[model samples]
Target: MCKFLQHTGLHQCVPSPAGAAEGTPTTHQWMLRASNSVLMLLPAYHNERVFMLAYWILDLGSKKKKKEKKKKKKKKKKKKKKKKKKKKKKKKKKKKKKKKKKKKKKNNNNNNNNNNNNNNNKKEEEEEEEEETLLKIVPTVVCSGG
Candidate 1:
Protein backbone atom coordinates (compact mmCIF):
# COMPACT_ATOMS: atom_id res chain seq x y z
CA MET A 1 0.00 0.00 0.00
CA CYS A 2 2.66 2.44 1.09
CA LYS A 3 5.09 0.90 -1.37
CA PHE A 4 4.88 1.52 -5.10
CA LEU A 5 2.87 4.23 -6.86
CA GLN A 6 0.05 3.22 -9.26
CA HIS A 7 1.89 3.55 -12.61
CA THR A 8 5.01 1.72 -11.38
CA GLY A 9 2.83 -0.43 -9.14
CA LEU A 10 2.54 -3.15 -11.77
CA HIS A 11 -0.59 -2.04 -13.58
CA GLN A 12 0.44 -4.37 -16.44
CA CYS A 13 3.79 -5.83 -15.37
CA VAL A 14 2.67 -9.44 -15.77
CA PRO A 15 5.42 -12.03 -15.27
CA SER A 16 7.04 -13.44 -18.40
CA PRO A 17 6.33 -17.15 -18.98
CA ALA A 18 8.90 -19.89 -18.60
CA GLY A 19 11.09 -20.77 -21.63
CA ALA A 20 11.07 -17.09 -22.50
CA ALA A 21 14.47 -15.81 -23.63
CA GLU A 22 16.58 -14.58 -20.69
CA GLY A 23 18.38 -12.14 -22.91
CA THR A 24 20.22 -9.25 -21.28
CA PRO A 25 17.83 -6.39 -20.55
CA THR A 26 18.12 -2.93 -22.07
CA THR A 27 17.20 0.49 -20.67
CA HIS A 28 13.50 0.58 -19.69
CA GLN A 29 12.71 -2.54 -21.68
CA TRP A 30 9.18 -3.84 -21.04
CA MET A 31 10.06 -7.41 -20.01
CA LEU A 32 9.44 -9.34 -16.82
CA ARG A 33 11.81 -12.25 -16.37
CA ALA A 34 11.85 -14.45 -13.26
CA SER A 35 13.37 -12.53 -10.37
CA ASN A 36 13.99 -13.23 -6.69
CA SER A 37 12.53 -9.89 -5.61
CA VAL A 38 11.23 -6.84 -7.41
CA LEU A 39 13.10 -3.78 -6.28
CA MET A 40 10.85 -0.70 -6.27
CA LEU A 41 12.55 2.00 -8.31
CA LEU A 42 12.43 5.71 -7.51
CA PRO A 43 13.32 8.31 -10.13
CA ALA A 44 15.67 10.21 -7.82
CA TYR A 45 17.78 7.11 -7.09
CA HIS A 46 18.05 6.32 -10.79
CA ASN A 47 19.90 9.59 -11.33
CA GLU A 48 21.82 9.41 -8.06
CA ARG A 49 25.18 7.89 -9.03
CA VAL A 50 26.62 7.76 -12.49
CA PHE A 51 27.57 8.51 -16.04
CA MET A 52 25.88 11.35 -17.97
CA LEU A 53 26.10 12.97 -14.51
CA ALA A 54 22.45 13.95 -14.10
CA TYR A 55 22.21 15.07 -17.69
CA TRP A 56 19.05 12.94 -17.84
CA ILE A 57 16.88 12.71 -14.76
CA LEU A 58 14.28 10.06 -14.18
CA ASP A 59 10.92 11.56 -13.20
CA LEU A 60 9.88 10.18 -9.79
CA GLY A 61 6.48 8.49 -9.64
CA SER A 62 5.60 8.92 -5.99
CA LYS A 63 3.10 10.78 -3.82
CA LYS A 64 0.78 11.35 -6.80
CA LYS A 65 -1.68 8.59 -5.84
CA LYS A 66 -1.12 8.94 -2.11
CA LYS A 67 -2.22 12.55 -2.07
CA GLU A 68 -5.25 11.74 -4.21
CA LYS A 69 -6.39 9.00 -1.87
CA LYS A 70 -5.88 11.24 1.14
CA LYS A 71 -7.90 14.05 -0.40
CA LYS A 72 -10.73 11.66 -1.25
CA LYS A 73 -10.90 10.36 2.32
CA LYS A 74 -10.90 13.87 3.73
CA LYS A 75 -13.76 14.87 1.42
CA LYS A 76 -15.80 11.86 2.54
CA LYS A 77 -15.23 12.75 6.20
CA LYS A 78 -16.31 16.33 5.66
CA LYS A 79 -19.50 15.21 3.93
CA LYS A 80 -20.29 12.90 6.81
CA LYS A 81 -19.69 15.72 9.27
CA LYS A 82 -22.09 18.00 7.40
CA LYS A 83 -24.76 15.31 7.36
CA LYS A 84 -24.37 14.79 11.09
CA LYS A 85 -24.70 18.53 11.74
CA LYS A 86 -27.89 18.71 9.66
CA LYS A 87 -29.36 15.72 11.52
CA LYS A 88 -28.60 17.41 14.83
CA LYS A 89 -30.28 20.64 13.73
CA LYS A 90 -33.50 18.81 12.90
CA LYS A 91 -36.36 18.72 15.40
CA LYS A 92 -35.63 16.39 18.36
CA LYS A 93 -39.16 14.93 18.11
CA LYS A 94 -38.65 13.54 14.54
CA LYS A 95 -35.32 11.99 15.54
CA LYS A 96 -37.01 9.40 17.74
CA LYS A 97 -39.36 8.32 14.92
CA LYS A 98 -36.51 8.15 12.36
CA LYS A 99 -34.36 6.14 14.73
CA LYS A 100 -37.07 3.57 15.29
CA LYS A 101 -37.71 3.21 11.53
CA LYS A 102 -33.98 2.93 10.84
CA LYS A 103 -33.54 0.19 13.45
CA LYS A 104 -36.48 -1.77 12.02
CA LYS A 105 -35.14 -1.44 8.45
CA LYS A 106 -31.66 -2.46 9.57
CA ASN A 107 -32.99 -5.57 11.27
CA ASN A 108 -35.06 -6.50 8.25
CA ASN A 109 -32.16 -6.08 5.83
CA ASN A 110 -29.35 -7.66 7.87
CA ASN A 111 -30.21 -11.26 6.92
CA ASN A 112 -30.63 -10.53 3.22
CA ASN A 113 -27.37 -8.48 3.22
CA ASN A 114 -25.20 -11.34 4.44
CA ASN A 115 -24.07 -12.37 0.96
CA ASN A 116 -23.08 -8.81 0.05
CA ASN A 117 -21.04 -8.52 3.24
CA ASN A 118 -19.25 -11.78 2.46
CA ASN A 119 -18.50 -10.69 -1.11
CA ASN A 120 -17.09 -7.39 0.14
CA ASN A 121 -14.85 -9.27 2.59
CA LYS A 122 -13.52 -11.52 -0.18
CA LYS A 123 -12.79 -8.51 -2.41
CA GLU A 124 -10.84 -6.82 0.38
CA GLU A 125 -8.76 -9.99 0.87
CA GLU A 126 -7.92 -10.12 -2.83
CA GLU A 127 -6.86 -6.48 -2.79
CA GLU A 128 -4.60 -7.17 0.16
CA GLU A 129 -2.92 -9.99 -1.77
CA GLU A 130 -2.36 -7.64 -4.72
CA GLU A 131 -0.86 -5.05 -2.39
CA GLU A 132 1.61 -7.68 -1.19
CA THR A 133 2.71 -8.56 -4.72
CA LEU A 134 5.99 -6.94 -5.81
CA LEU A 135 6.86 -5.12 -9.02
CA LYS A 136 9.54 -6.65 -11.29
CA ILE A 137 12.87 -4.83 -11.18
CA VAL A 138 15.13 -3.98 -14.10
CA PRO A 139 18.82 -3.45 -13.42
CA THR A 140 20.50 -0.38 -14.92
CA VAL A 141 23.83 -0.91 -16.68
CA VAL A 142 26.60 1.66 -16.44
CA CYS A 143 30.01 1.91 -18.15
CA SER A 144 32.74 4.54 -18.20
CA GLY A 145 34.95 5.34 -21.19
CA GLY A 146 35.81 8.07 -23.66
Candidate 2:
Protein backbone atom coordinates (compact mmCIF):
# COMPACT_ATOMS: atom_id res chain seq x y z
CA MET A 1 0.00 0.00 0.00
CA CYS A 2 2.88 2.38 0.83
CA LYS A 3 4.61 1.47 -2.46
CA PHE A 4 1.41 2.17 -4.33
CA LEU A 5 1.05 5.52 -2.59
CA GLN A 6 4.71 6.42 -3.41
CA HIS A 7 4.23 5.46 -7.10
CA THR A 8 1.04 7.51 -7.33
CA GLY A 9 2.93 10.59 -5.97
CA LEU A 10 0.18 11.04 -3.40
CA HIS A 11 0.21 11.43 0.38
CA GLN A 12 2.21 8.92 2.43
CA CYS A 13 0.39 5.82 3.50
CA VAL A 14 -1.67 6.29 6.66
CA PRO A 15 -1.08 3.38 9.03
CA SER A 16 -4.14 1.24 9.22
CA PRO A 17 -6.37 2.02 12.19
CA ALA A 18 -5.43 -0.06 15.25
CA GLY A 19 -6.85 -3.62 14.81
CA ALA A 20 -8.36 -2.63 11.37
CA ALA A 21 -7.42 -5.19 8.66
CA GLU A 22 -5.75 -4.10 5.36
CA GLY A 23 -8.11 -3.76 2.34
CA THR A 24 -10.97 -3.18 4.76
CA PRO A 25 -13.73 -0.72 3.83
CA THR A 26 -12.58 1.67 6.60
CA THR A 27 -9.01 1.86 5.15
CA HIS A 28 -10.35 2.42 1.65
CA GLN A 29 -12.56 5.17 3.00
CA TRP A 30 -9.55 6.90 4.62
CA MET A 31 -7.58 6.72 1.32
CA LEU A 32 -10.54 8.10 -0.61
CA ARG A 33 -10.89 10.97 1.86
CA ALA A 34 -7.22 11.91 1.54
CA SER A 35 -7.40 11.79 -2.29
CA ASN A 36 -10.56 13.95 -2.28
CA SER A 37 -8.77 16.60 -0.13
CA VAL A 38 -5.75 16.63 -2.51
CA LEU A 39 -8.00 17.04 -5.54
CA MET A 40 -9.96 19.88 -3.92
CA LEU A 41 -6.71 21.72 -3.05
CA LEU A 42 -5.61 21.53 -6.72
CA PRO A 43 -6.80 24.02 -9.41
CA ALA A 44 -10.34 23.24 -10.70
CA TYR A 45 -9.65 21.45 -14.07
CA HIS A 46 -11.77 18.49 -15.20
CA ASN A 47 -9.02 17.32 -17.60
CA GLU A 48 -6.34 17.46 -14.87
CA ARG A 49 -8.48 15.29 -12.58
CA VAL A 50 -9.00 12.78 -15.40
CA PHE A 51 -5.29 12.69 -16.20
CA MET A 52 -4.33 12.24 -12.56
CA LEU A 53 -6.89 9.41 -12.23
CA ALA A 54 -5.58 7.76 -15.39
CA TYR A 55 -1.92 8.10 -14.35
CA TRP A 56 -2.67 6.60 -10.92
CA ILE A 57 -4.37 3.58 -12.56
CA LEU A 58 -2.05 3.03 -15.54
CA ASP A 59 1.43 3.58 -13.97
CA LEU A 60 0.69 1.73 -10.73
CA GLY A 61 3.08 -1.22 -11.23
CA SER A 62 5.45 0.31 -13.85
CA LYS A 63 9.04 1.13 -12.87
CA LYS A 64 10.36 4.70 -13.00
CA LYS A 65 12.39 5.51 -16.15
CA LYS A 66 16.19 5.86 -15.66
CA LYS A 67 18.08 8.85 -17.14
CA GLU A 68 20.73 7.84 -19.75
CA LYS A 69 24.38 8.98 -19.39
CA LYS A 70 25.76 11.02 -22.30
CA LYS A 71 29.17 10.16 -23.90
CA LYS A 72 31.78 12.97 -24.37
CA LYS A 73 33.56 13.21 -27.78
CA LYS A 74 37.40 13.54 -27.92
CA LYS A 75 38.77 16.77 -29.56
CA LYS A 76 41.91 16.72 -31.82
CA LYS A 77 44.64 19.30 -31.05
CA LYS A 78 46.04 21.29 -34.05
CA LYS A 79 49.85 21.70 -34.54
CA LYS A 80 51.15 25.31 -34.68
CA LYS A 81 53.63 26.09 -37.55
CA LYS A 82 56.89 27.95 -36.83
CA LYS A 83 57.42 31.25 -38.74
CA LYS A 84 60.95 32.16 -40.15
CA LYS A 85 62.23 35.65 -39.21
CA LYS A 86 63.90 37.87 -41.88
CA LYS A 87 67.21 39.75 -41.18
CA LYS A 88 67.10 43.59 -41.72
CA LYS A 89 70.16 45.30 -43.42
CA LYS A 90 71.69 48.38 -41.77
CA LYS A 91 72.19 51.55 -44.00
CA LYS A 92 75.43 53.71 -43.73
CA LYS A 93 74.99 57.54 -43.66
CA LYS A 94 77.65 59.79 -45.46
CA LYS A 95 79.08 62.81 -43.57
CA LYS A 96 78.96 66.26 -45.36
CA LYS A 97 82.14 68.54 -45.38
CA LYS A 98 81.65 72.25 -44.58
CA LYS A 99 83.46 75.11 -46.64
CA LYS A 100 85.54 77.82 -44.79
CA LYS A 101 84.72 81.54 -45.46
CA LYS A 102 87.63 84.15 -46.19
CA LYS A 103 87.47 87.43 -44.18
CA LYS A 104 88.77 90.82 -45.73
CA LYS A 105 90.91 93.31 -43.63
CA LYS A 106 89.69 96.98 -43.29
CA ASN A 107 92.09 100.11 -42.87
CA ASN A 108 90.50 102.05 -39.91
CA ASN A 109 93.23 104.85 -39.63
CA ASN A 110 92.12 106.67 -42.91
CA ASN A 111 88.46 106.86 -41.83
CA ASN A 112 89.45 108.29 -38.40
CA ASN A 113 91.74 111.03 -39.94
CA ASN A 114 88.96 112.25 -42.33
CA ASN A 115 86.43 112.60 -39.46
CA ASN A 116 89.00 114.57 -37.31
CA ASN A 117 89.78 117.09 -40.14
CA ASN A 118 86.05 117.94 -40.69
CA ASN A 119 85.59 118.61 -36.94
CA ASN A 120 88.74 120.96 -36.81
CA ASN A 121 87.51 123.08 -39.80
CA LYS A 122 84.07 123.63 -38.16
CA LYS A 123 85.75 124.83 -34.89
CA GLU A 124 87.98 127.43 -36.72
CA GLU A 125 84.97 129.01 -38.52
CA GLU A 126 83.09 129.41 -35.18
CA GLU A 127 86.13 131.19 -33.55
CA GLU A 128 86.37 133.71 -36.40
CA GLU A 129 82.65 134.66 -36.11
CA GLU A 130 83.04 135.27 -32.35
CA GLU A 131 85.99 137.74 -32.87
CA GLU A 132 84.03 139.87 -35.41
CA THR A 133 81.03 140.18 -33.07
CA LEU A 134 83.36 141.37 -30.18
CA LEU A 135 84.97 144.07 -32.38
CA LYS A 136 81.54 145.52 -33.40
CA ILE A 137 80.39 145.69 -29.74
CA VAL A 138 83.58 147.65 -28.69
CA PRO A 139 82.92 150.50 -31.17
CA THR A 140 79.27 150.89 -30.04
CA VAL A 141 80.40 151.23 -26.38
CA VAL A 142 82.95 153.96 -27.13
CA CYS A 143 80.35 156.07 -29.03
CA SER A 144 77.77 155.84 -26.22
CA GLY A 145 80.37 157.01 -23.61
CA GLY A 146 81.26 160.14 -25.61
**Number of the top TM-score candidate:** 1
Clashes of each: 0, 0
In candidate 1, clashing pairs total 0
Candidate lDDT values, in order = 0.51, 0.45
lDDT of 2: 0.45
Tens digits of lDDT, candidate 2, 1-146: 34444444443345556675653334344345465544453354445544475446334423322111111111111111111111111111111111111111123456567778988898999999999898888664444654
Query: What stretches of model 2 exceed 4 Å from their correct place?
Result: 1-106, 139-146
Where does candidate 1 clash, by residue pair? none
TM-score for all predictions? 0.26, 0.23
CA lDDT, candidate 1, residue 143: 72
